[model samples]
Every structure is written in C-alpha cells, then in structure tokens.
Target chain A: MLNIIWPVFIIISFMYAIVTGRVNEVNNGIFEAVSDAVELSITFLGTICLWNGIMEIVKKTTLIQKLTKLLNPLVKVLFPDLKHSQKAKEEISMNMVANLLGLGNAATPLGLKAMKTMQEENCKKDTLSNAMAMFIVLNTASLQLIPTNVIAIRTSLNSANPTQIILPVWGATIIAAVVGVLATKLITKKIK
Target chain B: MVNYISAAAIPFIILGIIIYGLIEKNKVYDSFLEGAKEGIEIVFKMFPTLVGIFLAVGALRSSGVIELIVKIVEPMTKMLSIPSEIMPLALLRPISGSASMAVAVDIMKNYGVDTFVGLITSTIMGSTETTFYTIAIYTSAVGIKKTRGILVAALLADFAGMIASVIIWRIMSTSFC
Candidate 1:
C-alpha cells in the first residue's frame, strides 16, 4: 500500500509544483521533512520508553492477564482465530487499553508488540493474517475515550468549552469503528 | 474536572501498575529496563518508514496539491453541506497527524473554537486516525507486504469519521446555539 502511495505522493507533488511554479516550496518541504521526522522520533523516545517500561512490569505481574480478561470478549470477537495465541491476545488487549486511554505513544509500542506476537506463528511470511488485518483496522478506526491532546490545544486557544467536543468525537469514532470492522469482515469473507 | 482527570491519568496508571507489580513480587525494575531497550529498538526500526512518510506528506502539502484537490471537490462538499475550510483537513487527517493538527488549529484561530467549523474540526481530529502512518508502521514492523485489504478498510473508516463529525457537529451547533 505504502509502496504505491509513497511514490505517487512524491511524483504528483513534483509534477504539480512544476506545473504551478511552486517548485521551490516543494523542494524546501522535502528538505526539511527528514528533520521533522527525526524531531518527532526524539519526542516519542521518552514517552515510548516510559510506557513500554510500565507495560513490561504489567506483563510481569497478573495485571496483564486481568486486563486481558477485561477485554476478552471484545478481543475474541475481533480475533477469534487467536484462541491459541494467548500472548498475541494479551498484547492486543494491552494495545486496546493504551488506545482507549488516548496514549498514542504507548499504543504504538504496544501495538507493535501485538503485531510481532501475531507474526510469530504465521505460516505466511508476507501476507497479513485475518487477525492482523482486523487489528490494524481497530487501530485505524481509533476508538479513543478522551482526546486529551485535542482538549489541550482547544484550551490553549481559549475555547469556552474545551471538552464540549468529546461527546461528538465519541459518536464519530464509534461509527467509524463499526464501519471499519464491518468492512474488514466483508473483505475477509469475500477474499477467502 | 476533565482537564484534571486527563492530566492525572498517566501518573495514576503508572503508580497503580508499579504498586501491583510490587505486591506480586515481580522484578519490575528489570522488566522495565528490558522493555525500554525494546522501545529504543522499535523506534530505530520505524525511523526509515517515518522519514519516507513524512517526506511524501510534506511535499504533498507544500506543493499546493491539497488546495487544488479541495478546489476540485468544493462543489461536492458544498452540496453535502460540508465547509470548504475543513476539506484540506479531511484530506490530511488520515495522511499525517501533525499536518491535520496544524490545519485544525488554523481553523480554530480563524473561526472561534466554539463555531461550527471549529467544532467539526475538533471532532474530526479526535476521532480519525492517521491511517497511512499507523498501517505502514504496523505492517512494516511485522514484514507484511500484502496490505491490500487493510488500507481500503482503514481509509473507509476515516471517511466515515470525517462525515460523522460534520453531521454530528451540524446537529449540535444548531440545537445548542
């Protein structure tokens, strides 16, 4: 997917800029983009380490199992074939918890962990499993409870009610998630 | 109260996890160090993908391509009663997180945050995910090359979120104000 989109982005940008005489702007954008990515990586480093560390401790105790138990019904529905992959189920549960808490930093690392575990016993090397596809859809739909970052930005901008959008956001995400799950399930069945 | 809860959430979760680990007689410190090391490795592995995505997204944004697309889609969006101010945002939200945030912030600055546009922007920002970034990282980390169905489903979901945001906020702004 990225293999196609990434190149198309570069090609179209250059083509459009050349046609529209915005070549310099495109050049500057490309030049500064790597540094921007590096800066973001640096910012993510501390938070990622902190959350990963905490998650490790959680894994060591029974907390992971408890959390997994709490999320079991949802996880089972999402990845029913993962009945034997207990580790994958646990990581998926952890990732879901992190996402619901609106912890983007924590969620990525936990999600990567989930993906790694799911890949451990895969017979296919390059193709995604049904469970993996469903998991990615769940992440993409983003069923976050409290959008802390959005509220913070609104507060900074002096909004009268920074949290007023929460209810609407919940409505949007729930609908998005349902659509995503249905779409994935449809595609999975059709493909199989 | 919302602000207070958001601020305290992380600290409370961390403290609770630590105390639980201690009660379980687990090697919390050692486990943390190990996990932290893995985090560093994961970041390094993701760096190349990040750079590629950021470069493409940056170029796309700066080339006026999005504005061009918005202009093309203006009539359709207008018919749907979606504001033109948020078209770029709807386009960028799934591509890049920071770009969408910048656009959302710009919208709020131009129009007050309580306005319909601002409200919809915030709702969209909160609900939608960066589908490209998340899918790329997750699939690449696991060495999954055939990401055929995932991208389609994810982008569809983002579209749903964007439309849902606009409709909900429209109803909300009308009823509340």
Candidate 2:
C-alpha cells in the first residue's frame, strides 16, 4: 500500500508546488520533515526504552502469563490462527493492553514486538499474513478509553472542560474498531 | 480528577510490574536493561521508514495540496453536514499524526475549543490513528514488503471514525443548545 501511496504523495506535491511557484517551500518542507523525524525519534527513545525495559521484566516473571490470561479470550477471537504461536499471542495481548490504556508510546514497541513474532509464522516471508493484516487494522483503528493527548491539548488551550469530548470519542473509536476488523476479515476471506 | 488518574496510571503500572518481578525472584534490573537495549534497536530500524513517511507528508502539507483538496471536497462534505473547516483534519488524520495534530490545534484556536467544530476535531483525533505511519513502521520492522489489503481496511476504518465523530458532535451540539 505504501509502495504506491508514497510516490503519489511526492509526485502530487512537486507538481502542485511547481505550478504554484512554491518550490522553495517544498525544499524547506523536506528538510524540516527530516529534522522533525529525527527529533521525534529522540523523544520516542526514552519512553520506548522505559516500557520495553519494564516489559522485559514482565516477560521474565509470571506477569506475562497473568496478563495474557486476562486477554486470552479476546486474542483467540481476533486471531484464532495464532493459537499455535503462544509467543505471538502474548505479545499481541500486551500491545492491546498498552493501546487500551492510551499509552501510544508504550504501545508501539509492544506492537512491533508482536509483529516480529507473527512474522516468524508467515509462510511467505515477504507477504503479509492474515494475522498480520488484522493486527495492523486493529492498531490503525485504535480503541482507547481516554484520549490523553487530545485532552492535554484542550487543557493547554484552557477549555471550559477539556475532557468533554471523551464520550463522543469512545463512540467513534468503537465504531472504527468494529468496521476495521470486519473489513479485514471479509477481505482476507475473499482472497483465500 | 481524570487528569490525575491518567497521570498516575503509568507510574502504578511500572511499580506493579517491578514488584511482580521481585516477588517472582526475577532479575528486574538486568531484564529491563536488556529490553531497553532492544528498544533502541527497534527505534533505529524504524528511523528510515519514519523519514520516508514524514518526507511525503511534509511535502503534501507544505505544498498547499491538502488545502486545495479540502476545498475541492468541501461541497460534497457540506451536503452530508460535515463542516468544511474540519476537512483538512479529516483528510490528514490518517496520513500523519503531527500534521493532523497541528490542524486540530489550528481549529481549536480559530474556533473556541468549546465550540462544535473544536469538539468534533478532538473526537476525530482521539478515534483515528495515523494509519500510514502505523502501517509503515509495523510492516517495515518485520520486513514485510507486500501490505496487501491492510491499507484499504485501515483507511476505511479511519473514514468511518471521522464521519462518526461529525455525526455525534452534530447531535450533541443541537440537543445541548
């Protein structure tokens, strides 16, 4: 998907910039984006390490088993094909927990770990597996109880009630997750 | 009250995990160090992909292309009662996290955060993920080249979330007023 999307973005941007004589802005945009990426990575490094370190402890202890047990039923329902790969299932459960808590930073590392584990079970190395496709959709259609970032942004702007949108957000989030999962299941089934 | 709990949640989780490690007689410090090291490796692996995505998104935003597209789509969205002010955010929400965030902030600033437009923008931001960024990082980490049906499904989900946000806010704003 990114294969086509990435080039199309670049082509459109350049074409529009040239026609509008905004070539200099495009140059600055590229450079600014590179620096922003680096800055984001640097900021991400700390939280990633903190959570991954914490998760490592979770893994060594029986905490993973307990946590996995809590989420096992949901995991089984979502990715039944993953039953044979307990490791993948455990990682996915952890990722789901992080996401549910609205911990975006923590979720990414756990999610990447899950993806890596699922990749091991892929028969065709380069192609995305059914489980992998479902997992991506789940992450993209994130379902969280509270939207910390949006709330924080609102508070910073001195809103009368920062978290007023939380109820509406929950409604939208659940709808997104349901649609995303159903779409993935239906499409992948058709392909097979 | 909500803010306090959200802030305390992480610390409590960390403390719980460590205590569990101690009770289980696990090497908590060593394990954390090992995991932290792996975390660094993961970030390094993701940097190249991040750069590519950021570059494309940056160019798209800076070129005024998104704004142009939003203008073009404004009529169709209006027919559905979707505010044209949020069209840029609805479009960018799936593409880039920071870009959508900036747009959301812009909306909040232009229209008071307590207004209908601001409420809808906040809801959309909360519900939808940065689909392109999430997909690129997850797929590239495991070296999966063919993304197949993931993009379509993810984007469809994002669209649903955005529309849902608009509808819910419209209903709320009307009833409350």
Worst 10 residues of 1 chain B by lDDT: B1-10
Encode model 2's per-residue lDDT on A61-158: one tens digit a residue: 75434655798899899998897998999899888877876657668999999998998889989989999999999999987765766765676666
- Stretches off by above 4 angstroms in model 2 are A1-68, B1-72
**Candidate 1 — which residues are off by over 4 angstroms?**
A1-67, B1-72
Lowest-lDDT window of 10 residues in candidate 2 chain B? B1-10
DockQ of each: 0.47, 0.47
Q: Give TM-scores for every candidate, taking all chains together and pairing residue i with residue i.
A: 0.68, 0.68
Give one digit per residue, the lDDT tens place, for model 1 in A79-104.
98899998998899989887876657
lDDT of 1 by residue, B23-132 (tens): 99988899999878876876676667667766776787789886777788889998988888788678778887765665576567657888888989999999998999
lDDT (C-alpha) at residue A137 in model 1 = 95
